[model samples]
Target: MLTDVLKPEKTTRKNAKPIWLMRAGAASELETSVQDWVDASAFKAGAGTVLVVPDRKPGGIAGAVLGLGDGDDPFVSGALASKLPAGDWFFDSPSTADIRLASLGFLMGAYRFARYRKFPEERPSLILDGSLDRSELVALAEAVWLARDLVNTPANDLGPDGIEAAARLVAKDRKMSVRVVKGGELQKKNFPLIHAVGQASQSAPRLIDMRWGRRGAPRLTLVGKGVSFDSGGLDIKPASGMRNMKKDMGGAANILALARLVIDARLDVRLRVLIPAVENAISGSAFRPGDIYRSRKGLTVEIGNTDAEGRLVLADAIALADEEKPDMILDMATLTGAARVALGPDVPPFFTTDDAFADSLSAASLIEHDPVWRLPLWAPYLRGLSSGVADLCNVTTDGFAGSVTAALFLQQFVTGAKSWAHFDIFAWNPVAKPHAPVGGEAHAIRAIFAALRQRYGVTRN
Candidate 1:
């Protein structure tokens, strides 16, 4: 847990070393001896550069300096988490970092998915600022850590049942009520699409629903696509495309993480989370291309392609969420490769008809340092989803506007909500960054949480 690396006591200890954040051409701010030492060590204070000075009398270390180059992102302090020596450290005076963001970044930098590997070395920990909400910070970091851990785990270890088990753990830890409809029960419950996707896998498909907070509070519902493993079903993905199918369930992992954040923060809202867990594997019983199925919302869908399975499971779950017409609907899925091509993996593009909520998310994304771009929910793309055989098709043949069409397909079942937004995310991080490693990542949840907090005042239970 990244939160474990945070010192319980919020004040800086006397024994802890001071870490000064400096930028290029900031030599005048440093003390005379420190400035001379920095110059002697050839430290120009570029971003991610580190220089530690030694104490002459004690023969131990004195303090260290971190270069922030222009320091555009306050969370740039994340880089220092693994760079500095193992010990208690604090950001010192004459530094430019925002204490709260830097502190959060420090925790993020300390994250490691050590479930499979052995990490014998003790990592550095921070004495956090007293003014910051310690509990909130832990909740934020732990939410992201939980998502990363779930996504990083391979399919052999985490299937639909594995996802349900993890949700049970969250329910136990967060004092939430959870119920599941698995196997044939999903079909009886009007979730034929979810069953169709997972019928081929040995692990049964499931619908995991978790609820929390007061009954009359503002209703906020979330739906996530939980394709445990996508061998691309009968259509099949090439070896390169299927290499990282283990992360197909990243949307479920992330939304569950967000649920954890909501419960931990004790937000004043009635929260409901729905995850349609399934594995799109090949077998004699797998749903084949050209198969037509009726969705929970009574809309018929033609299976144009078997690989486009994430949205299939999500459609049924979103329809179920719309049954009661909740205040808002937000569904997340690693649903399209076009999203990656449009905005790349680092910046997930979001679609929403609610302009005000989109603005809120934009502002929150900037403040929280969680990057997300708003893509239009173009109504014109709806025609591409139309089918002569069924009410709609799972995918289009032309392959143009893949992301937009996918979002439009999910929007068909969202008539009852006050507002609805969809996120097409590439959950896997292809390269390492200062705050995160190259693995499964929690993309825009922080920004979304921040927006929700501002929207609904913080009157926690």
Candidate 2:
């Protein structure tokens, strides 16, 4: 999809503009003519600043210069795709790592939601001459763009059926196996929690199960919460809070993004993707706050709040994922507002019982620029989720630790997996950054993918 954004070549054209990257106060070291032009233009090399120098020949761009502020973060180069004039461009760098990072930034920056903007902008193409692997970077950009597109679409166009359609498309594209249990089949299948959450909507609730890779490979299961639109059922959210509810299915979009990376890279993993698709809308049949539903895992959970439906759907899905006794289980959800309050929108909070997996994921997060922070699955918080009648409630009544208790609530259904982690992600970029535009965003999957690849990387003899 976005593969064309990056062009691989044995050599770059002489006319291709060389982008000279610099930190503050580094412009004085440039060649005499370029330095004079930069100085004359008062280019201070501030972060995200770009200035195109004119060639000695009239009206032509000789090259461009970019500012990196402290030179610590290379992703500032991301803005170059939109800021630079349409033409061929190459980074004037000797370091492989910087080039790689800068290239990634450029590829992501090239994204434009063309669905609504029918006319395409004249885009600049990055020319690479043996600096990086084009395939992996292209795969990352394509997957991220796919997730963003799904997240940015309005709820009218993206409902429960829309989410299921997306999963079906992936299965067809990859030629993988897919099985769906929908409507009354969900009831017959014993997915009581998932059905209860969506029974109020016209679109039926369903579980999308997709599998890929060899049967004997290490099992890696991914579960995503697919609440297409959360009207909060009978407990409706205020207008302001419900305005962006379309992005509620962000967790499902991100799981598909990561699944693309895993399958495209041909990793040595037997992957199972489980998506519980539903729409939490209000109606006469809507499940009430005090209602208790027996999950597919046979754990009774009292509905403490109607707005906490993400975990309800995911509980059944994750319980199903654990049934296979997979080596790892990772579920991502736009489950709680408290997560945003705790870490803001950019840094998601992940909870896991495995120390080694946490350390590996943390390391990968920084390297991949997909930030995630670890929150404890505090056993003491288990008391916060305790219920008087049922086995456990969906949320803590005191609300002292909303995000922590949410993770603990999901952790109850994951006893069978060797290692399990829950990613409480925002999945939406409320504010625009140099690289990421505002709307549905792909978070944490890159880092998670990198870690999984390292753990189960295929070795060919």
Assess every candidate by TM-score.
0.97, 0.97
Clashes of each: 0, 0
Q: Which stretches of candidate 1 lie over 4 Å from their true place?
A: 10-12, 26-28, 94-97
| Residues 322-420 of candidate 2: C-alpha lDDT, one tens digit per residue | 999999999999999999999999999999988898999899988888899999888898998889999999988897889999999999999889999
> Which window of 10 residues has the lowest lDDT sum in candidate 2?
3-12
Output the TM-score of candidate 1: 0.97
Off by over 4 Å in 2: 1-4, 8-14, 27-29, 459-461
What does candidate 1's lDDT look like per residue over 166-216, in tens digits? 999989967789999999998898999999999999999999999998998
Candidate 2, lDDT over the whole model = 0.88
Q: Which stretch of 10 consecutive residues in model 1 shows the poorest summed lDDT?
A: 90-99
